[model samples]
Target: MVLIGYWLIEKLFTFEAYKTRNNRGFIIRQITHHKTKQEKERQREKLINMEKRVLYGLVVMLMYLVGGGYSQGVVEWIRDKAEWEEILVKTEIHIGVMVTSPLCGAPCDIVNDQVARFVETYGDRIKFYKINVLETLFFALDYKILTVPTVIIFKEGTINLRFESLSDWGMFYELLVNSSILDFPPDLSPAPAPAPSDSDPDADLPPPLQSGE
Candidate 1:
């Protein structure tokens, strides 16, 4: 039975790898056909790098599976290292919404909606990320997340604010405003005209003559 399972796993991975190779070849052909000499060389280099990354990923997965999950420690270590690297190296202010699956009901739904709106509103200024706790337990544990629909804001590689079970958009907005992470939505109203100053020679000039005067 174990041997059969291993064979099945190998076949599955082989099929996936074959598909990936076909796709990669097609993309490379297209790149070569369209690009000039310099661009073609650069693009081919990039494709080769991408292929290496994909192959490395597959090898890592096969090793894990073939070894009967013996690579679990190595995988965890890599994940932790990558997480810390991201936290420390990223320059943008990060807003992470941690939620359970969509099937978790009303709270998750609310969080999803609010997170979408928040991203749409402030996406240019902040980096927004969503973590599904059910799918990514490593992130949940790393962030010490204990509740569903938790929101965490990170500034300068440190946790700035964390709120659990947030359901109200208004309250969340207020928190962001109060914490000075985000300024209140700019008043779309036009700025008042500056008071005329003695130094403004242009203002003293009479309005330009209208055409056909």
Candidate 2:
């Protein structure tokens, strides 16, 4: 009876040892799996952070490029401001003197047309002021303009050139050209004659009847 009891106890203790070993193996596997999952999560977080940093850097670089281009454009535009201002001021004042009475007819019209042409041609370089003789007799007398259409080129608030009747474009152009106000030469060529065509009636005119024997 004692031997039988001792054998049964030994068998039970061996079975209990096998169960304990298996439980220990399962606990070790669970710990290893948990560690692997934690490591993967940490790597994913690092990659996301890296991507964010790269995106931020790109945004900063783009902003700098835009800002720098804008600054350069603004600087260039400001650089031309002074030259434009000087041109505006000079163009507001022009080269003309007051004309007084004893002036009328074709001469008056010619002078007015000349002044208008001067304004058209040199509008960018000079100003035009017209003082009619009948209207501004006092001013014409003050300038001692005995002639009907007298011109005075004013520079720096002083008289530069005084000339009588600009009867032709050449005469006026010469006045400014000699004084350095007109830098370029004017066109002086005569117009060309029209070409003959078969469709023209004059071209188809019959020759005079023969009279010679």
Candidate 3:
């Protein structure tokens, strides 16, 4: 939801670019004290509409994902709090999961589509999970999550990093990279024996003791 929101916002800014990329002409007009109040209002109106589309688009995309089309096996979905807790304590390396919603807009949709590749690449380093805010509302309330695509990186059940809104695939990449903080357990094999000494073993024996006696 967060990722798509940002993408939509980016798209909206470009949706109404004035004549050119910079819109420097508008700036020049403003500097010269030219009469351009109507243009200002137009831009404002565009901004307003952009916001509306962002919200609406998010809802539409979320609905589509809730159905069977959402990519499965990309990341394990947490069905209940028991499952969430089990993963937290049992996993040795660290934990990373996303808190999202069924109603989340384009940002969540974008993350849903793009995150599978990173998961496949880094799935060995650490396991990734997704918690539905609607199904598991307790986790969301516990984490104080009000937005979709919030990511929590934790180790041994302790949170290390938290992203309030995941607005792009980069966040997923970062999560995978950081999950390796506690990589595979150290090797536990015994040490090798030392090399044999070169000196004679009986050199210091009682060869001279008999004569002295």
Candidate 4:
């Protein structure tokens, strides 16, 4: 009653099944190639992102060198008796002892930068001076600056506060607020600057005198 012709069945098999089976390998290869291309594209994007980050950091450094974030020439370096006299006689002054030697590591440089950056705004009201211990070791010894990065505050021509190895802005802020000296940023505090152990110029100095001598 219902017998399909062999010729018609052969025609359908050749058009649909045979053709699809013949193209299956090519289709599989195309899919594999597209997957590989997508993976390569992802890797390329990641590499580009990494390069952009590095470039952005370089741009920031260049801008800073050109006086981008803060104004330059505010913090003066102290290296002579005349300069010391000026700071000493000033009504309000901040003297920072910093290490400028090539061997100075992260901690020393960080503390030095903290003071230098802070002086951008405060320098107008109060004088600020930086003493490089490597250049002028005598000043460090005279001021008892055993720490590589110590900040000594002078108000009314007298030593007001001595911050030894000053690490963060919290202690500096609190002290200044209590003394009514400097109004520093409260929430924008940076990471504490610790004393570098191995490569500090201050380490070569004679050990601190024992108590009750």
Question: Per-residue lDDT of 1-213 in model 4, one digit per residue for the tens?
Answer: 134577787788789987898699789999999999999999999999677556545544554676554435366678876767766776444443343444544444444445556566455545666777777777776777666556677767667677765444324434544554555434667889886688678975799988994
TM-scores for every predicted model = 0.43, 0.37, 0.52, 0.44
lDDT of model number 3: 0.68
TM-score of model 2 (CA atoms): 0.37
Model 3, span 122-181: residue lDDT tens: 555556788888889879877888777887778777887777643444355555555554
- Could you tell me how far off, in angstroms, the CA of residue 94 lies in candidate 3 after the best superposition? 2.0
Q: Rate the local accuracy (lDDT) of all candidates.
A: 0.61, 0.56, 0.68, 0.61
Q: Mind giving the per-residue lDDT tens digits that candidate 1 earns over 80-195? A: 44665665576565545444565555455444444554555666556655666766777777788777667777777778778885544325545654665665455789999877
Kindly report which residue stretches of model 4 are placed more than 4 angstroms away from their true locations once superposed: 1-73, 90-102, 167-179, 183-213
- Candidates sorted by TM-score, descending order? 3, 4, 1, 2
Over 4 Å off in model 3, which ranges? 1-73, 166-213
State the lDDT at 65 in candidate 3: 65
Q: lDDT score of model 1?
A: 0.61
The candidate with the higher lDDT, 3 or 4, is 3
Instruction: Compute the lDDT for candidate 4.
Output: 0.61
| Consecutive 10-residue window with the lowest summed lDDT within model 4 | 167-176
